[model samples]
Target chain A: MSEPTPHSMSETTSTTDDDETQRSTAADPADPAASADPTPVPGETGGKFGRYGGQYVPEALMPAIEELTDAYQRYVLENEDGFMDEFRRRLREFGGRPTPLQHAERLSERYDRDVYLKREDLLHGGAHKLNNALGQVLLAKYMGKDRVIAETGAGQHGTATAMAAAHLDMPCEVYMGERDINRQRPNVFRMTLNGATVTPVTAGRGTLKEAISETMRDWAGSVEDTHYVIGSVVGPHPFPAMVRDFQSVVSEEARRQAIETIGELPTDVVACAGGGSNTMGSFAAFLDDETVSLHAVEAGGADLSIDEEAGVAPNSASLYAGEEGVLHGARTKLLQDAHGQIVESHSVSAGLDYAGVGPELAHLVDEGRVIPVAVDDDHALEAFHLLSRTEGIIPALESAHAIAYLEAGTDTEAGTDSEAAGDDGGEPDAAADDSLGETVVVTVSGRGDKDLESVIEETAARDIDGAPDMSAFTEGI
Target chain B: MSNRAVSDRSGNSEAIAQAFADGPAYIPYLAVGDPDYESSLEYVEALERGGADLIELGLPFSEPIAEGPTIQGAVVRALEGGMTPDRFFEFVEDLDVDVPLVCMTYYNLIYQWGETEGPRPFVERAAEAGLEGFVVPDLPAEEADPLREACDEFGLDLVFIVAPTTEGDRLDRIMDRVSGYVYVQARLGTTGAQDDVSDQTAASLDRLREYDVPKAVGFGISAGDHAERIVAGGADGIIVGSALVDIVAEGVESNRSTAAVADRLEAISRELVAGAERGSRARSTGDPS
Candidate 1:
């Protein structure tokens, strides 16, 4: 099939004014209470997203949480001139900010959509995680804390934090699960080379959850001199709000760049959600823009269907299958069993292998501001290869979930052509109208270097007679 | 029965008030079902015989974030012995002991039972099982309204912790709602036996005395000297956990019989209880300075 021109695709959508009118009338735009107030009101107990977020920690850590919250409010938010300026300087000189928003031409043609890739994979630590790390480490310094600690699943956050600590001349320690350390060996080495002490946690299921619990324990003991720079938008009050504010630059820049490059905002914005930092960052700017739909793709592991008794397939989609419960200090949607014991999550991408998501995403999901979908391991693996071959950009397994959704035509309503663009199948597109063509932006949250081993192993297993039929694997799904 | 006048403070705070009115309270902590449920019961009985004023029953959880290695190991051993929340309550309901029992556990066990609705289920069950109060190490005073409300409705005192780092406003907030003796953390770290009482313990106790609640110092009071110093510094009770838990762990590691472990625990409990008595005498005589 011949590829359509970008101009032809752009012409298919309605005028910008008409689109804006339709979107404003489609639903009650942003919650005035949330959008109008930027800073946390004084005496507000916990930084809440609707009713989803709260500080549910032990008494031993309350004083520390209070101290950190005070410091963050006074030094970082109120006096941004002193702290945030230095943080932004470091982000520019050391962490490489203002990353390009590149148009994925070949892949866009294959999908018959105008797809733009926010190039966070080109960041200093090869992921968008450095944005939060640099900003938080700066705040730690401003708080007069000489030591820093963090927890990691795929080690990207650990590597980014270690790099920031090295730059700031602070002693850094990172807690990682023993299972994750083995899989993400390269990033672990990178963290060690940056002078971080990587402590391997062996408690519980030995994954991200255990690492976070261990980090909290360490902070409880050494709260005076150490600051725990939580990697994702999870955890207690100031952390989820702070990390999201630090990462908001991702969407802020992308929103401006989309208008500058394509004359208007993309019809839909997509990102992957684990603890939901990148998703929140990519969706924060467009939340008030009713015309732009926000979609988050979660790791599906095996299947996207729910099974309460067996709890087997699509084990990682907390928003889809989880109930409201408290975990690691926040009350959010958690993948828990009937007795409230947290169930172990399975995902090929270690970054998205958590059993809980950020409470803010939970609120957005509840408000219908954000749509969540799940893509299994098979589809993500296929997208990981397709992006490399078509766009010459190898995306992290977590980001590949977003690409997989596009390939599977699951997000056609949000964006893309309804004619089933890609080689998958056009038969499913007969029900929807093909006249409405929309532009979509997918966030390449990180580089795929850490996942090369798993990808090679998976490809080797799918090989038939020493030749891998990549198309055959992704055809039916 | 003639001492009934001293126990008339209030129905909810009677147990702690009576214990404090008599003398310094010596509280020993043991993880319930550690090693086994039957032995755990014997340990509690031995503590009561050894003159313990009250006992803290620990509910073992898979993740005890506020615990040091000593208590963490005990929790692991208890869970390995197939202890669950249901079994813990069943054993506690039938436990025969003289001293009042307060549960010391992480918040997740209670939170899991409540399941994001409220902490009423766990508090009600604990009350049904004869528990007098709860000390959730992780549920701070600021986020404790739900559990505190449940505790009040169930006629249970909710004990709150006052750490060395807890200062002016935060200390006042924690002390205001505390019904039982205030749990004063002697040091800046997790539960373990330290060589000496923290230098800040004296000042922390002095600050805690500004409030009306009785103070009990914990988180490293192992030896008699440590207990005496804490109580002499104005602490109404001395809370010891790791030292007693270490005895249970050591006994299990060395293949000692349950009776031997109980005897060892009782012997140490007697020494600490004597130290608490001496400290009480010093406080009454105004001689610690």
Candidate 2:
């Protein structure tokens, strides 16, 4: 066999009303705007985050997507008395709505900045995931779907979904990666106790990506009476927008609290980006406020800076290190190889171990509305311990990444400095202080209870000389 | 030389139009390089001999979200057998089949091959490898303009899927630039074997008939009976995927020979072809309701 030239092939192929059709329908290649802005606008009618999110699913699931989109628009977004009221009631009654905006006095003094923690960690199910779960479960009820399916990474979302489903008396199935199931055993047990059948996904590095693929396949197979309660602001159109809308309450409350407590809007809002739910939620209300800087912390995993030996930064910082690609039904910044196959992301926190960031976050990164920072495992672990010691809060490793951002000094990019210095009780490098202004709010996405085992193992492995002894914390259980 | 002639006859609009012109065509799907490469080659040949009008060669990706368990298992086997894009194309280049071969793949594979600045290289490579078109399950029309332009430039057909839920302007947008037959899913689920076709299948096809393109119904189409019923419902062609993948998977599980797998696939393909013919005849004679 010989290679055929493209010119020869095009010449010989049949032309079936080509010129007429081409003229009528072909997209104009000359138009720069058509190709320039790849990210979809957030909250667009069709679940677009500029151009990043759209329904890129199988044909079989199109009806379900449409049905869900229709229901979301009709009963949730537009319905004042029916869907929204019930969702608010459930969030208030069950999910413990309006989680406090606590002044991190001790942590603030340590860093020489007024730091506040958006206490989603204090909410029901011990995370902000309950907010989305409550809202989506209410939407499922409105859509008359009796069964709910979800995919979880750290199991916080799964536990939250299970709680909501149990509260609604709906059967729930949660798909979790085998690795996550092992690491997040506490949350897995919580989900099981809530009556959700947790199916362990063993495919594709056994992480959030695989769990999502498995859950999507399940949704594809059972779209009629089942609703996929996507844990984050990811997946196909409607999901990213819908989840962001549900979690937007986080920022709305934070904004109001900032005004009431701080006497002014926050100078900077920080949140970790793992599929970017909390980040989008915390940043959504402050998007138009140019004065309020938005900082998104991605899990740096081992290291994000260029390492000579590895030849690449092994990190989940898609906005910083990844390129545009489609994953789990939406086009977003993905941690993909040269060949576009998704590379495995490593993070101490399973919640941040995702190859793709949410489309809305990707859009914000493009627009420069959100500054993307990647926090390394060591710094995140340091933040995890520092919060526990100073603030008496054991933050989820995912949330620790956000605190690591502040610890690293807001001005400098995360994972840039190799030295771990936050726990020395000395002020962070003066350079670090200049970048992060006073009055910063970090979204404490979840409590660290589900991540205690992984944290213990990681902390033990690090064995830093000045690290806080975690022995007392892990002594009992 | 015979293979060259077959390649020349395929990969064009005329061939696909001709296949559907006679009657309702039977298009059988096989995950390329499943079980092993050589076995997959034999399976393709058997499908052609078994009267397949068109063949959908599935290039298995690491994650096939649109697929059901049967196709997913086949993909796992294919990947385990080391079926990379280069090997998949090499196999296609060597295949001496007569039927028009449309590659079924995810968009990422194509996106990965092309540079960020230029026309997609995958479309050019696919044309050179003797593929007629693409059936990217994940590339919706909204995100499909770039690929569609590449396909237009490469002289390849870009098939679009019309689901039961696709209506109003979305359906129009999908059908607007479709070069090959439109893929009509039988139900609201992934590809798998089903006992009966849903009533929505008929309605979907009926809705699609207003468009000028030929319609091929797939997803959950398992048996010859399904083929018959779907074709009778006015589909210009029947695309059977998971059911055929299951046969190959069963053969591999049972440790059957490559020829045994080929033979089994051939038998099933023949049965489906017969059913398509019967359904075509029934439609022509006004015997189908």
| Model 1: per-residue Cα lDDT over B1-289, one tens digit each | 1122122113364666677777789999999888888888898898888888888999886667778888888987887676777888898887888678888876766877844456888888888888888898867676777777777777778888888888877776676568767888888777888888887888788787667777888988888877777788888899999999999999899999999999989999989988888887887899974
- Residue A153 error, candidate 1, Å: 1.5
- Per-residue lDDT value at A398 in model 2: 92
Go through the candidates in order and give each one's C-alpha lDDT. Answer: 0.79, 0.79
Scored against the true structure, residue A216 in model 2 reaches a CA lDDT of 93
Worst 10 residues of 1 chain A by lDDT: A423-432
Backbone clash total for model 2 is 8
> Any residue pairs clashing in model 1, and if so which?
A58-B138, A59-B138
Q: Write the per-residue lDDT of candidate 2 for residues A1-477, one digit (tens) a residue.
A: 022211222333333222221222333233222222223442222556555767778765777888888887788768744888888887889888879999999878776678999999999989999989999988998789989999999998999999999999999999999988888888888999999999999876788988999899898768889999999989887888788888988988887788778877777888998899999889776654445667888888886643322223467888777788888888789877665666677788889888888887887677656777778888899888888877889999999999988866643434343222221111222223334667889999999988877887778778754566768767765
lDDT over C-alpha atoms for residue A416 of model 1: 45
Cα deviation at B184, candidate 1, in Å, is: 0.6
What DockQ does every candidate get?
A: 0.43, 0.36
